[model samples]
Each structure stands twice: as C-alpha cells, then as structure tokens.
Target chain A: MRHGRRRGRLTRVSSTKDKLLDATVETLRTHGIAGVSARTIAATAGVNQALVFYHFGSVDQLLAAACATATAQRVEVFHERFAEVGSLRELLAVGRELHTVERGTGHVAVLAQLLAGAQSDPRLGEATAAALDMWARELETVLDHVLRRTPLAGIADVAGLARAAAAAFIGIELYEGADPQGAGSALDALDQLGAILEAFDDLGPVASRALRAKVRQVTSK
Target chain B: MRHGRRRGRLTRVSSTKDKLLDATVETLRTHGIAGVSARTIAATAGVNQALVFYHFGSVDQLLAAACATATAQRVEVFHERFAEVGSLRELLAVGRELHTVERGTGHVAVLAQLLAGAQSDPRLGEATAAALDMWARELETVLDHVLRRTPLAGIADVAGLARAAAAAFIGIELYEGADPQGAGSALDALDQLGAILEAFDDLGPVASRALRAKVRQVTSK
Candidate 1:
C-alpha cells in the first residue's frame, strides 16, 4: 500500500511540473514575455502560486526550465527528419515545413518573446542562446554530412553556415509577422539559392573542378 | 517684441521635444523596452515627466517618433556610402562597417529590444517594421543597381533579397550578443556568398549564359 501511494504521489508531482511548463509557453504565446509572472503562470497552470516557487525556486528559473523543455521537445520531434536530409535544398525544404508547423503551434511567438526578454536579462539570454544552440547543433550535423563531398566543404565554414541558416529562419519567422509577403519572397529567394547549390552538385567532374577553382580563387582574395 | 518672445517660446518647446526624443533612445539603450516609461525617459532627459505627455501624447507615441527619427538620421548618414557601392561585395563591406558602428553605439541593442517588443505590441510592431523598411529601401536601391547586369537580376527577387539581407544583419546583431564568435562566422559566411556572387558577375558571357541556364533549369522544378 505504501509503495503504491508513493508512486501515485510522484506521478502527480511530475504532472504538475508538466502543467507549469505548458503554462509558461501558453503565457508567452498569449501575453508575451512582459506578462510572465509567478501569479500569472500559476493562474495559467491552474495551480497555487506558491507551487511555482516550491517547484522551480523562482520565476526566472521556471522560465529557463520552460525554455529548455519546450525547445527540447520541438527539436526531438524534428531529429529524425533532420537525420534524413540528403542535400542543402532538402534541408531548406525541411526548414520551410518546420517554420509552418512552429508558427501554427505558436512556438514561434514564444521564441520571439524569449529572445526579446533575453536582450536585457543575462540569465534569460543564456537560456535563449542555449535553446538556439540546440537547433544550430542539429543543422551543423546535417551540413557536415551533406556538404562533405561538395566544393563548399573546402571553402565554407560549415558551423557558421549552420548558424546563419538558423538565424535566417529565426529572422524570417519574426519578419513574417509584419510582412508576410516579403517573408515568403525571402524564403523563395533562399530556395532559389538552394536550387543553384543543387545544380552545382550536379555539375560534371570537369565543370565541378573549374567551379571549385574559381570559388577558391575568389575567396582567397 | 511680442513676435520675438513668441519665437523664443517656440524654440524652447521644439528643443524640449528633441530632448525627449534623445532621452527615449537613451532609455532604450540602457533599460530595454520593458524599462521604458515616461518616468524613465523624462529622468534620462532631466526634464519634467509631464513633458512626455505634453510633447508626444503618450509613451508609445514618443517611442514611435523616436524610432522614426533615429532611423532616418542613421539612414541619411549612410546614404552617400550606399550610393557609392559598385558591387555586392562592396555592399557587404559597407554592411560590416555599419555593423561595427551600430554595435558600438548600442543601437543594435535598442533595435533588438524594439523588435522583441514588436512581437507583442502591434503599435510597436508597425513602428519597428517601418524603421526596418527605411534600411531595406536603401538596400533595395543598391541591390537593383549592383545586380542589374548580373545573372541574379533575372533569377533573384531584389526586394526580397533586400529584406533578407536586413533580416540577416538583424539576426546576427542579436545573435552576437549571445555568441560573438558564432556571429563572426555568420558574417564571414555572408562575405563568402558575396564573393561568389561577385565572381559570377566576372564570368565570361558564355559561362554566365550556361550558369543562368542551369539555375533556371534547377529552379523551375
């Protein structure tokens, strides 16, 4: 009887923690970063405000924890898809799909709020950067695999390119809220670049050698 | 004597408005968007808090005016340099220089705060996007001029590319606050792209025709 009761109590506690995390994201989507508070989060979670301090120590801690949890869940969902990416163009296609899904789920709004909050708060900044790093790491792995055989592998900074791609998506996500058409055009422009890259990959060996030489020559200067 | 006194009073009022505008930007620099208020702005300006309402009607209006004024001033300063840009690589060079200057002035921090605030506040969002558009307009003009003879003119969306460039710089600015080295690599990656584009511009006519044909074929599907 005692063991069963202990397991039951642990399950409740874990569920409550999950509730708080969900509440944090919901509040960010609805109220933005400025609306976040102990009372607000507890209210959103339908738990006692004291439970927040008891479970997470402070609001900032809860926010940091929430950021990490939310980002981890989203990243995990996309991991298998990321692993299957075969080319730069395919990677961008996945990015477009991720953008659509994230925007629909309101994750993009939450991320925008967190990133904004990060500007003034060092703790929040670290948490947000850590969250972005999660995406960048996933992209870096794919870039390493896909670009290894391309001419870009010799001249491109794969790690930096990954971050740049991440940043571009982030920027487009926020930019879209204001100018949807412009954002679409930006995505299309990126797709065009991806197509060019794919073409480069399809080049004959002789043409590939000449293109690589030109890229090296231009970049060296 | 009455006309002279009236003129003097008008001068004082205009100067006070200017002071508030300057203070608004300073507050954004030091306190971020959340910290901005009539009290903080007035305190920074060393003036009566009531003057913010008297001059601009409300804090949001004051912020909107400040954003417009500050962005206009900065854009004007760069107008001559942008007009002189002869190639895509030169434009990137000017961008690097502008990034350094903006970072030093703490304008990047201010922009990050406004952009974050924009996510939640439609009023601020409009103001921020308007400010971003000012920069984008300048860039579009340059991109149109520089890419006119290049193959990208037919394949690239110039307006979209301009916004993408602006978004990239904005993303890099905020990303730099968290990961400076990663930001540097991102900028370098863009420089590499610019170099590649410039090299394409230098290609012989036959090679350019072949490249354009390949790009179109790849993009068509």
Candidate 2:
C-alpha cells in the first residue's frame, strides 16, 4: 500500500513538472515576458500556486528552466531538419521551411524573450548564446561537406555564410511576428536565399580558391 | 494670471512627457519589454510614479510611443546614410555602416523587442510593418532609378530585391546579436551582402529588360 502511494506521488510530481513547462511556453506566447508571473504560470498549468514554488523554487529559476527547455527543443529541431538537406538548393529550401515552422510555433518569440532578458539575466543570455553557437558549428560542418563535393573552388566562408543565413532566418521571424499576412508571401525569403546563392557564385574562381585554401588552413590549424 | 499658470502647466507637462519617453527607451534597453512598468519606468526616469500615468496614460501606449520614436529615428538615419549610395557596392557599404552603428548602440536589441512584442500587440505589429514598407519603398526607388539609367534590358525587381535586402539586413542583426565576436570580423555580413549583389546582377539581361518594359508599361498605363 505504501509503495503504491509513493508511486502515485511520483506520478503526480512528474505530471506537475510537465505542466509547469507547458504553462511557461503558453504564457510566454500569449502574454510575453512582461505578462508571465509565477502565479499566472501556475494558473495556466492548473496547478496550485504552491506547486510552482515546490518545482521551481523561484520565478527566476522557473524562467531559466523554460528557456533551457525551449533552447534544447529548437536545437533538436534544427538538427533534424538539416539532416534532410543534401544539396545547396535543398539546404536553402530546408532553411526556409525550418524558418517558417519555428516562427509559427512561437519558438522564435520565446527565443527573443530570452535574448531581451539576457542582459539583465546573465544565465539566460549565456544559455541562448550557447544554443546558437551549437547550431552555427553544426551548420559549418554541413557547409564544409557541401563545399568538398562542389565544383566551386573554396568553401566560400562557411562561418560567414552561416552567420548571414542565421540572420536572414531570424530577420524573417522579426517580420513574421510583425506581419504574418504580409510576410506570408514568402517572396522576401526566396529573394534573400537567391542573393546568398548568387553571392556564393560571385566569389568566382579566385575568391572561391582563396576561401577553400582558408577553410583548409583553418580546419588544419 | 490664468495664462501664466497655463504656460507653467504646459511646460511641466511637456518636460514630463519627454522624460517618460526617455525612460521608456532606457528601460527597454536595460530591462527589456518584461521589465517595463509605470513604476519601474518612473523610477528609472527619476520622476514620480504618477507622472508615468499622467504622461503616457498606460504602459501599452507608452511602449507604442517609444516604438514610434525609435522607428522614426532609425529611418532618418538609414535614409541619410543611403541617400548618397550610387552603386551596388556603395549600397552594400551603406548596409555595413548601418549595421555597425546599430550593433554598437544595441539599438538592434530594441528592434528585437518590437519584433518579438509585435507577436502579441497588433498596433505595434502594424507600426513595425509600416516601418518596413517604408524602407522597401525607399530602396525600390533607388533600384528603379539605377535601372532607368542603365542600358540594362530587364526590369529591376526593386520591390523583390528590397524585400530580400531587408531580410538580409535583419539576418545581419540576428547573426551579430547571437555572435558579437563573429560580427566584429564582419565576414558573415559582408559575404551575405556580396551574395545579394551577385543575385541582383544575375536576374539577367532579359529579366532586366522585361522589368524596365514592365515599369514603362505600368507608368504609362
């Protein structure tokens, strides 16, 4: 009987934790950083207010945990989506698709919250930066692979390209958040992608060769 | 006596209003959207708490006003910078300069706030969209002028290119925000800009001619 009671308590505790996380995301989406309060989050989770104190200890810790959860989820999603991209064109396509999915899911806004709060909250900023760095490294590896196979001379500044690509992705989120209907045309996104590709080609033989040499030198070093 | 009292009241009110706006921006930069409050902003501004309510009426209105002020300032700066850009390279140069200024001042973080907050606030969202549209229109005019002067055959997809360019600009902001050290090198921003310019050239002589023809046709019609 005692074992069963303990098992029941454990189940309740786990369920409460899940609720807290889910509530955190929902609150962030609807009310944003300013509106989220421990009381509000607990209310959204349908748990007692005291449960929040029990699970998170404090609101700052709760927010940090939420940011971590969101960051891990985003990194996992990027890894999965990029895995599907094989060619240069396919890579751009995947980038756009992933951009739409992430923005629409409110993940980007959550990220922005972490970013905006980061200056005041050092832990949140560090966590967000770490997540972005991981993604950039992954992208760099993929670009290196693509460069190795292409007829193009050098890797074409993978780090630079990745940073630009990431900016373009986030920029869409910026516009998408402001004007979903307007941004829906996808015209802007495609145009930028085309520009990135053209820029790659513009480097031509000399720039490409230099870039390739640089990539090799850096990777070796 | 009434007139003198009125003048004194008006001066006090205007000063209070200016102080409130300044506080809002500082609070946004330091604490972000979440930390903005009448009490908090008032405290930051070194004014009485009630002055926040007296000047702005509500937190939402205060934020909206702050957004409007910031957007106007940015547009003015961009227009002044790009007014002299006569070629594609010059245009890219302007882009680099604009981003450098934005990053150094952390104005981009303020932009991030509006971008993320727009998800929740329709008024702010519209304001942001309107700001972007203005940017697009200005860039389109510049491209249109260039197309007219050139022996180029196809129409310049100015609107399309502007949208793409804007996306790239935002991308630069995102990349720089996430990776300040990388941004300092500016490899990513420069590479992305090069890509956009190359693509602009590649829209082809045929497309350029068609675009010019279309422009003529539309203007005439």
Candidate 3:
C-alpha cells in the first residue's frame, strides 16, 4: 500500500514539474522577463508558489530549465527537416518556415525574454547559450555537408558560419519587431546570397576553377 | 544680478540632467536592465532618486533619453570615419574598429540590456530601434557610395543591406558573449564577403559584365 502511494506521489511530482516548465515559458511569452516570478509562474501553473522553489530551487533555475527544455523539444521537432536541407537556399527556406512557426507560437517572445534576462543572470546566460548552441550545432552539420561541394568548402569556417547564420537569424527575428520592412529586406539579401552560391555551384568546371582561384587569392590577402 | 542668477540656475539644472543621463547609461552598463531603477540611476549619478523622475519623468524615459543621447554622440564621433570608407573592405575594417571600441567602453553591454529590455517595453523598443537606425543610416550612406561602383549597386538593396549589416553586427556582439571564437569566425566570414566584393571590383570589364549578368539572372530566378 505504501509503495503504491509513493509511486502515485512520484507521478504527481513529475507532472507538476512539467506544468511549472510550461508555465514558465508561457509567462515569459506573455509577461516578458520582467513579469516572471514564482508567484506568476505558480499562478500560471495553477499550483502552489512553494512548488517552484521546491522543484527548481529558485525562479532563475526554473527559467533556465524551462528554456533548455523547450529549446530541446523544438530542436528535436526540426531535426529531420534540418537533415533534409540539401542546399544553402533550402536551409534558408527551412529557417523561414521555422521563423514563421516560432513567431506564431510566441517562442520568439520567449527567446527575447530569456536573452534579456540572461544579460542580468549568469546562470541564465549559460543555459541560454547552451540552448542556442543546440541550433548552431544542427546548422554546423548541414553547413559541413553543403559547403564541401562548393568553392567555399575549405576556405570558409563552417563552424563560424553556423554560429553566424544562427546569430543572423536571431538578430533578424528581433529586428523584425522593430523594423519589419528592413527585416524582410535582410531576409531577401540572404536569399540573394544563397542564389549567388547556387549560381557558383552551377558554374562549368573551368569557370569554377577560375572562381575558386579568385576566392582563394582574395581571402588569403 | 537677478538675470545672472537665473542663467546660473539654468546651467545647474542642465548639468544635473546631463549627470542623470550619463548615470543611467553607466547603470545599464554595469547592472544590466534588471538592475536599472530610479534608485540605481540616482545612486550612480550621486543625486537623490527624486531627481531622476524630476528630470526625465520616469525611469523608462530616462533610459530612452540616455540611449538616444549616447548613440548620437557615438555616431557623431564616427561620422568622419564613416565618410572616409571608400570600399566595402574599409567599411568592414571600420566596423571591426568600432566593435572593439564599443566592447571596451561597455556600450555593447548596454546595447544588449536595452535590446533585452526593449523586448518587454514598447517605449524602450522605440528608442532602441531609433538608435539602431542611426547606425543603419550611417551604414546606408556608405553602402550607397561604395556599391555604386560595384556590380551589386543596382542589384542589391542598399537600404536593406544597411539594416542587415547593422543587425548582423548587433547579433554578433551579443553572440560573442556566448561564443567568442564563433563570433570571431562570423566577423571573418563578413570580411570574406567584403574581400569577394573587392575582388569583383578588380575583375576585368568582360568578367565583371558576365558576373553582373549571372547575378541578375540568379537573383531574378
């Protein structure tokens, strides 16, 4: 009888923890970082405020957990899509799709809040960076696969390109909030770059050789 | 004597306001957005907390004023240098110099906090975006001048490029906090892009025409 009751309690605890995480993300989406607190999160979760401290030790820890958990889930959902990206342009197309869905789901707002909160909290910054890295790592894999066939193969730093691409998307996401037209233009510019790369890839062997030599000569300088 | 005293009083009031503005920026630099308050700003300014409200009406107003005032001064300082940029490579070089200087002066940190704070605050968002526009405008002018001679002049969107460049830098600055090496790579990637543009400028007429046509074709598609 005691074992059965303990098992039931364990399930309840796990469910409450999940509820708290969801509530934290929701609060960040709706209230921004400033609106987040144990009271608010617990209220959103429909549980006692003490459970936050009990489960996560503090609100900051809960925030970090929530961000990491949510990002992991989101990244998992896109893993196959990211794997299917065959070209730089296709990668960008996926990015656009992801951006649209993330914006609609209010995850973009949640990201902004976490990034803002991270500035003031080191623990949160570490967690936020970790979450960001998950995306960067996925991008790096694709970049490695795609760039290997391009003139930029060895010359470009694939790792850096991955982070840069991730960062650019993050910046555009936030920038869109302030200047939608400018953001759209930035997106278009990226597409243009993608198209240019595709054109480079389409070059005949002799032209490709010449282009590679030129790219090498310029980058080396 | 009465007129002299009135002028002296006006000078003191202006000086106090300046002190508050400077303090607000300092507070943001050191404490992040979460640490900013009338109490903190006044403490940093060595004035009574009431002075913050008395001069700027509210903490948010003070932050907006400080961001605008500081950005204007920084942009003004760079006006001559920006005008001297004769090439995309030079512009990137200037961007590097500016990044280093801004990072050293803690303005980058302030920018991060403002961007974060802006996520939740519409008024702050307006002020931050306006400040960002100041940089974008400067970049747009330079892009117009440099790209005018390049194949990309009519093809690329200069206005969008300016905002994109500005956003990229902003993203890079923030991303640097999470991954310094990756940030360096991103900067190098930009430099590579600049070098490519420079190389395109060095192309012989026939090659340039061919490249331009190819670019147009790809972009049109």
Each prediction's DockQ against the real complex: 0.47, 0.30, 0.44
lDDT at position A117, candidate 2: 59
What tens-digit string does per-residue lDDT give for candidate 2 at B42-109?
99888898976777777877877777766666777777667777766567667667777776665656
Ranking by lDDT: 1, 3, 2
- Give the per-residue lDDT of model 1 (tens digit) for A88-163: 8888889889989999777766776677677667887888889889988999999888888886776766777888
- Off by more than 4 A, model 2: A1-14, A151-155, A185-192, A195-221, B1-14, B104-106, B143-157, B164-178, B182-189, B192-221
- Against the reference, the lDDT scores of all candidates come to 0.78, 0.63, 0.78
CAPRI-style class, candidate 3: acceptable
Off by over 4 Å in 1: A1-14, A204-221, B1-14, B204-207, B217-221
Error of 3 at A194 (Å): 2.1
Of 1 and 2, the candidate ahead on DockQ is 1
Every model's TM-score on chain B: 0.87, 0.72, 0.87
By DockQ rank, best first, the candidates go 1, 3, 2
TM-score of 3: 0.88
Give residue A85's lDDT in candidate 3 (0 to 100). 92
Tens digit of per-residue lDDT, candidate 3, span B147-166: 88886778876777787777
Superposed model 3: Cα runs more than 4 Å off: A1-14, A204-221, B1-14, B204-221
TM-scores for every candidate against the unseen true structure: 0.89, 0.76, 0.88
- Give each model's clash number: 0, 14, 0
